[model samples]
Target: MRSRLLRTARCLGRDYTKPSAQALRCSGARWQSTSGREWSTPLAKTLAEAISVTGPLPVAAYMRQCLTSDLGGYYTSHNEGRDVFGQKGDFITSPEISQVFGELVGLWVVAEWMAQGRKSEGVYLMEVGPGRGTLMDDMLRTIRNFPALASSLEAVYLVEASPSLREAQHKLLCGDKPIEEIDIGHQSYSKYADNLKVIWTEDVRFVARDPAKTPFIIAHEFFDALPIHIFQSVPPSQPSAPSEITTPTGKHTLNETARLPRASQTNSWRELLVSPTPPYSNHASLGTPKSQQSSGPPPEFELTVAKASTPHSLYLPETSQRYKALKNSDHAVIEISPESQAYAADFAVRIGGGTAPTPTPSLAATSSSTTTTTTQARPVSSSKPEPVHKPTPSGAALILDYGPPSTIPTNSLRGIKQHRMVSPLSEPGLVDLSADVDFMSLAETAINASEGVEVHGPVEQALFLNAMGIKERAAQLVKRALDRERGASLEKSEGERRKEDLTETVKRIETGWKRLVDRGPQGMGKLYQVMAIVPHVPPKEGEKRRRPVGFGGDIVV
Candidate 1:
């Protein structure tokens, strides 16, 4: 039967696809003023072919196809080689908002290096999802201020999937240094110094970092972009459970999924009392109990959740979540991105390198077992690729993004285009889809990798920045502007030109500072968060006291 379906699919419309393909071109376009949610996409057409050969896929499977399909995946197509970030791009990131953001990041990395005994050896500096190279540019320039630290810097690696963005990074990061294209291909690295290599890859494994030297990884607004899945508990099935769960909230995309009109597929919005049957596990629970004041599901209860990358994988309950109260609430929707978890695990293995981790269990998806688990070898595409070489043992990674402190997620997946909210399904590939990062999950994943790793922070971004002297730095910049203006006015020949330059500089610096530390709800100050992964070494008793910089204040997690 499968063979017959495949044979039929090949001949049915191979030549007929072009006429209807525009409606389904799948250009990776961001959501905007458009309303053809039911239109066919090129990717959807492809999926339809597969479905012809197989059958309708689970909600997660459909989403993974739309976002990661090599043919026209959202990130894969480079958003049509259009800038997806900055003033003119689809959305603006924190680094693009101000140079100070990256400057403080650089200071934090250097301070961590210092705390790790100020190693003079080579240091691995890396950033994941480095948009247009602006953040790294600011960071590298700032690091230059400390000659000693800069001298010890061995390599700078960027983990970026888009080729268009990679070109932008190369142009900006190279500066005045003569350009050199040592290697140019689908996945390549540029050589700046004979020993120093600048690598850009969709997967993290290709970049080599000295395990012997301290490693610092920066992931800003990264985890949220990784694929995620959603689930809801329903009343117990009498004879047998239906293939998929359903609810009254109605179906919508959690950003990545292609929403369709199907009663049996999935629902988008968060709704309560989904089912009376309790499937209690460690990782499953009501997220906010302050309002519930109870530990179990209520009568006729339903709760939406995102457990794994695909609906077809195991939703194993775990016990270590810090927000036990949340899981108890009937209204809560629990979310956890196995995609991000797998990436964290892969990174941990590369840096820690103890016993090679047991291969992750492969998933065999089916209609009836959508919520069940079965083991088999899985594709490496869903997770970060393994590193080229076994990584040196000691490393530190800093992940900064907008999200909660805990590993659990509560309706955090969102879609944005032009900095405004849009339906994740409004334009399919034409919008930015993101969700909150589960820091706790990453910490636990890293801890399980090896004994040499430890986790820290997951602190408020506001606190992290203040501890790193952002306030003082902003003030200094303002003062310098005033000083420059005064100095420029006194010059005889170039006074007018100099003052003009200083005026523009002052305006830029002040505006950028205000936007970065703005106190509004949308502002980055408190809305964003930070987390760190470092080598684990027990401090000696009665040792000279010194804390890891940017982590001096009281921490909740």
Candidate 2:
């Protein structure tokens, strides 16, 4: 770890000493944005002093500043909505591409509400981190299809933390109906002082309302932005353990060898010790209850034992060589996101009900089979047990991100700048860094927190959209485009001359949508996944969620 850090420092030093063309371009862009003012203002001097004193800040910190800095953060100083679209933006989100994404999402929530028996009388249609309100507009437009749903929607709660983005969202969502704001503690709907039927805020930490009464939620492309902590495994003998100690005889030995039994000869015995510390520790303090700290390691660390071998038996003469070979060979890669789990757990508590064991503890325990022996044997504590799960209002929650059901050997952390891939370690906060989410772990965490909080996906985005009928919708759009093109061609008496142009345009749109759903090489099919969670019973015996025709088993939930 020290060596890696040193190497990184050296590389950074070299890069700084000889700024590349890219850095020059970035500096030129910033200079142009700041007008003719010199770069060395008192504020700039203070920032430089802070950086010099603190060494290098984490990429997450830099990103937070860049995106939300009071005076110069990307969102604060510029019109991000306008800047973050088309060929000029860093990257275009699905909602920015088409209204279909948000419309289908709104419909999905309605389906979830119906599935839960539509019990909530005044449900809140909430969106966390609504980007530019494009989603909200499309969703409300679609909700009008079901007038009852549109009317029942007590409020459109948007939880956004950025003032600039919030203003943008507000502008996009402006309508005759009132809009409300709900702070963490003062959550009454009357705060808006109008006929406000909806609200919006970003991040769950700020919501201050009874989740049970308004159990509908939406989070599109929100989880991906949450900071992630990453750690690479260093061999136990690699001198990276925190508890390093020198032997009394003046000899140094790996900490694991001294602490763990020497008889454990298998290289598989090694486990990467990583903690989901700050930036990744969900919006709660680390000192919170185990349930509240759901985004960290499960209370206990698990260790698996490998098969033992005889000390001197020459079962295999090439033992050391073979051991070395096997040691380098990648086995299982464990990727964990305590943040995602914490969020899911919180969602479960909100929708399913306070971590209370539903009336029939024994029956419910038996049915869910989630209660531990200790929890089953002990009498339920009377004192409202510190909420095991972080609290949130009731609502359907959707997590869409990149990742697979099982772990992969290679790390997924990568950087993106101007829609191009770059090294995560190269430019730090100047680029976006992300890792694939472990949806399976997230589902387990949510279910364990509260029963009947159904976690239905880690489904491929392509499949989810197809299940929601994106393909047919895209085809209709393409047909309309073709028709328009054909009319233009006929008017110009260039029917045959413009045939190729029309075909190419139609192909691009069709191909783009296909790429959006594509999974393998040359497609985003497998790269992005969409997941849905709702308060409801699991599908009945042998029954599965209805998927769109032709998508088949690809849509895993």
Candidate 3:
């Protein structure tokens, strides 16, 4: 099958095909190539070169190339709406799974905008890596209910790098609304450029804004996509200690051959057997004729053996000199997200009016005159002044990803193909490679970036959604279903059984949802955590400020 696919690809590459109708429509006159060969196009040649230099790229890179590559980019040749979403796409996200998710997010954004003084004509409803615009569609639909807030939307910024996905977003958003394209000056689109309002980049790293402005940012399952560096711990070593040697008594020594006493009836000790020395020297040797026994202790001795020790000791050896030689024996996995940290810091800085540069002062000469008489004065040297560290603007940044507050016992880095977990490192980019986000490290970075921005949650998604009213929504949905069933009006017995079944089904769903949200030994409640950074505000004289919604007062780290 592999060979067949390769042959087909080679054949397609060699054949001269005309540009598709979609490409011609999008590019206009630029589509006219005198050579009439699509494979010979510069983009195609570049893609071929890339493939030649590097073996099959990682799935992530492949997706990037398919969407953004200059030559034969998927967006140029396909209808974005038709290719993604529905039941035809690679996968469906939570936004596509339900409208409730996006509606809640819309509400969250409106609240954030209000908290930030609500001065601007509109806020940037930016969606990073919006897949097929499903989330945006739902969010916009929800926003329409609040005309005042909806109209405040200065622009809908779809900060997507994938051209295919971007086109889909464009179709979904660029109708009667004012839409501007923010070009990042590369094949990979990262930012949205509008007229002097604000710029939304691919990630927080490129957000061009002032911290005081307090632009509301919303990212759904965004941070989890970032690559994670994984490391494993080394194994421990076994301990070594010196012991005295001894030999069995009543056994033949040199020339004497005699049967020794049975040790616990296991067998007759007829021959001399060397062993480690006993801790207590209590056993006496029975002398025999012609036996030349020396006064010096035997080289070895033995003691009754006990049961084996726990396997944990072998795997986790202590960090002592006795096990120094075997220090590298034990191991555990560790994942680091340096890129995520740097990106977060950059986002914080950019939002806070671009990171201020440290200022350097020039030395100047100063002279003073003597009080009593006229005298020559010399220039005085002064030490350089230390630059001031300005505090970052107060605002909250929430990050939702798949990870825990501490290192997991088992490595969580995994891949999903057709919704099945596959070996993470098996197929390079062909499969998704992700590790659980270390919430503790992320909180530290957020706190370090600005004083007001405090970390929150790192709670389970189930808990978060429930706190945000998912349970209520589910109940409403079930109620509607039950009402529809009643409206059907079946036979008396049938209706009763159906009603009972519906009740049981609703109960089961509620239980499942609860299990999903609450912390359990085997459930998503404990598996997925949500972390948020809220701006710190001083409490009133006797009234405590309300904690951020969806988060308890306690911080994770």
Top TM-score: which candidate number? 1
Instruction: Report lDDT per candidate.
Output: 0.56, 0.50, 0.44
Q: Which ten residues in a row have the lowest lDDT in candidate 2?
A: 361-370
Strongest candidate by lDDT: 1
Q: Would you estimate the TM-scores of all the predictions?
A: 0.69, 0.61, 0.54
Error of 1 at 313 (Å): 5.0
Name the better of 1 and 2 by lDDT: 1
TM-score of 1: 0.69
Residue 440 shift from truth in candidate 2, angstroms: 2.7
lDDT-better candidate, 2 vs 3: 2
- After superposition, candidate 1 runs with Cα above 4 Å error: 1-41, 44-68, 78-81, 175-195, 208-210, 239-332, 349-393, 489-504, 543-546, 553-557
lDDT of 1 by residue, 1-557 (tens): 45745853442212111112223344444222122223224443444445546443433343443444443445544444466687776788888877888999988777777666677866778787887888888888788787777778777777765556777887787644443433321322333333445665444534543345566788888888765554343222223333344568764333222233242243222222111113243232332223332433331112333322332322322334443344344334555556566556656655565432321223212111111111112123445433424343566788888777865765665557676664443334555667778788788877876666677778888788777777788778878888867765365658777777778887887777666666588677777788877666666898633345676722221
Clashes of each: 30, 28, 28
How displaced is residue 523 in candidate 3, in Å? 6.0
Q: Which stretches of candidate 2 lie over 4 Å from their true place?
A: 1-82, 175-196, 209-211, 238-337, 355-395, 408-410, 425-430, 476-512, 536-557
Query: Could you give me the TM-score of model 2 versus the true structure?
Result: 0.61
Q: Write the per-residue lDDT of candidate 2 for residues 189-295, one digit (tens) a residue.
A: 32222343455433353343354465566767666664333222223333344455567777565556566544432433232221222222234322123332445
Model 3 stretches with alpha carbons more than 4 Å out: 1-91, 114-122, 175-206, 233-330, 350-395, 408-410, 427-429, 477-524, 553-557
